[model samples]
Target: MLEVKNLAVNYRGVTAVEDVSFRSLPGQIVGVIGPNGAGKSTMVKAILGLVPSTSGVVKFRDRALKQQLNSVAYVPQRSQIDWDYPITVWNVVLMARTVHTGWFREPSRSSQEIVKDALVRVGMLELRSRQIGELSGGQQQRVFLARALAQQAELLFFDEPFVGVDKKTEAIIFEVFEELKSQGKILLVITHDLGTALTKCDQLLLLNKQIIADGSMKEVMTADNIQRAYGDSIFIFNREVV
Candidate 1:
């Protein structure tokens, strides 16, 4: 399980996230949704220790999350990646094995096989030799997904995974998410998509800097909750949000 308590983050004396707390169990997909500048990404970064938190505690399986970094997989936003980097898709996914294989040592046969399998799962095996910068947006996203899979982590974080991807890639990612859920992996995804994909999550964390709502889709998508978080945005709820 994952637990976050009173997490907060500040950037250059400005508060980015405040009093964020949530718990997630295995075999569940939690969607973090909010409007722009809501600090959804910042909250995730704070939880992962990628950014310093002003105050908070992050625990996984009763221990501090930093102590179990090897069991965590993080796929940052595509914008954060340098697509111009001259690296092949295969090498990108294979990098995940470095945590276990050691940076200076060669990857073992099993590690190689794991990387291959991950690529195959994401349907990026054939593009393994291609440069990451040469692939389409969807294909590049799949490569990152493959890398995350190769890690075999218990907990995974994805930031705006469906952004700039084709429908096929979206389907592939959803399939992989279901597979990971079946394997008892915990997934926390930050997504702006609020259509069919939004309904797929077992829980939703609706935020506007701080958490406005955190519960099942039905609970978090209430009319008042949506209005509070999105603030008069043009959205038509399929169900009675009331």
Candidate 2:
């Protein structure tokens, strides 16, 4: 299980995330949704210790999450990546193994196999030798997905993973997410999608610099919660909330 209690972040005296708390169980996919600048990403970064937290306790399996970093895999927003970095797809996924294999040592045969399997799962094995910058947006996303899979972490975090992908890539990404859940891996995804895709999560965390609601799709998608979080911006889900 992942537990976050009173997680808060500040930027130059301005509170970005305040009094945020949530629990995610294994085999679950939890979606975090909020309007822009609502600290959706900040909350995740705080939990991961990427950003300093004003106050919080984050634990995984009763141990500090910071001590269990090896068990976590994070895929940041696509826009944060440098498309011109001149790296091959195979090498990109292979980098995940460096944490285990060390920077100067050759990857073990098992690690190589894991990388190959990850690429195959995302249907990017054929393009393994291609430069990441040369691939289409969807293909580039798949390469990152492969990198995450190669790590084989128990906890996964994704920020805006579907922002620039094709339908095929979206379908494949969801398919892999479900598979990971079945394997008892927990997923925390930061997304803005409010349509059918949002329903795939087992739980939802609605945010606006703080947790507005945390529950099932039905509970978190209520009209009242929508009004509070998104204000006058109309959002329709399954024609139920408008």
Candidate 3:
């Protein structure tokens, strides 16, 4: 299980996320939702050690996660990635194995095999030779998904994965999430698609600089909770949950 206790972040003396805590077990797809500037990404970054936390503890099965980052795979928001980099889809995905491959050493046969299998899984094997900048938005996302698969991490983190992709990409990602969860992989996806997330996420973490709600879809999507996270001005016509 993954445990986050009193996770807080400060940027130049400004509080981004504070007093945030949650628990998630394997085989669960957890969605992190909140308005812009609500510190959703900050919280994820803190746990990943990409950003420093003022005070917090992140653990996986009682072990400190920062000490074992090899078990984690993270895909940041699309805009954070540079698409113009002169790299092929194959090389991009191969980069995921760098932790094991090392800077001066060559990738083992196992790493190569894993990359090929990951590309096949994401339906991007045929585009292996193409440059990343040449692919469509959905294809680009697929490439990153392949990279994450190649890592073979126990924990997966995705931020705004569905923002600009087509419906096909969304469907493919959800299918992959279900497959990973069935294999006991825990996933945390930071998303804004509240409508689709209602049915897709196994659990939701509602945040507004702190955790407003955290639980199954039904438990977290209450009208009061929605107001607390997104403010009362936002319309929430569809609150139904399956």
**lDDT leader:** 1
TM-score of each: 0.97, 0.96, 0.96
Stretches > 4 Å off in candidate 3: none
**Cα RMSD for candidates in order:** 1.2, 1.3, 1.3
Residue 130's C-alpha lDDT in candidate 1? 99
Residue 77 in candidate 3, Cα distance off native in Å: 0.3
**Candidates' lDDT values, in order?**
0.93, 0.92, 0.91
TM-score of 2: 0.96
Best by TM-score: 1
Query: Relative to the unseen true structure, what is the C-alpha lDDT of residue 100 in candidate 1, on a scale of 0 to 100?
Result: 92
Q: Residue by residue across 158-194, what tens digits does model 3's lDDT show?
A: 9888888888888889899899999999999999887
lDDT (Cα, tens digit) per residue for candidate 2, span 1-242: 99999999999999999999999999999999989999988898999999999999999999999999989999988888899999999999999998888989999999999999999999999999999999998898899999999999999999988987889999999999999999999999999778756788998999999899999988888888888998977654334543
Of candidate 1, the 10-residue stretch with the lowest lDDT total is 233-242
Error of 2 at 179 (Å): 0.5
Which model, 2 or 3, shows the larger lDDT? 2
Model 2 ranges off by over 4 Å = 235-242
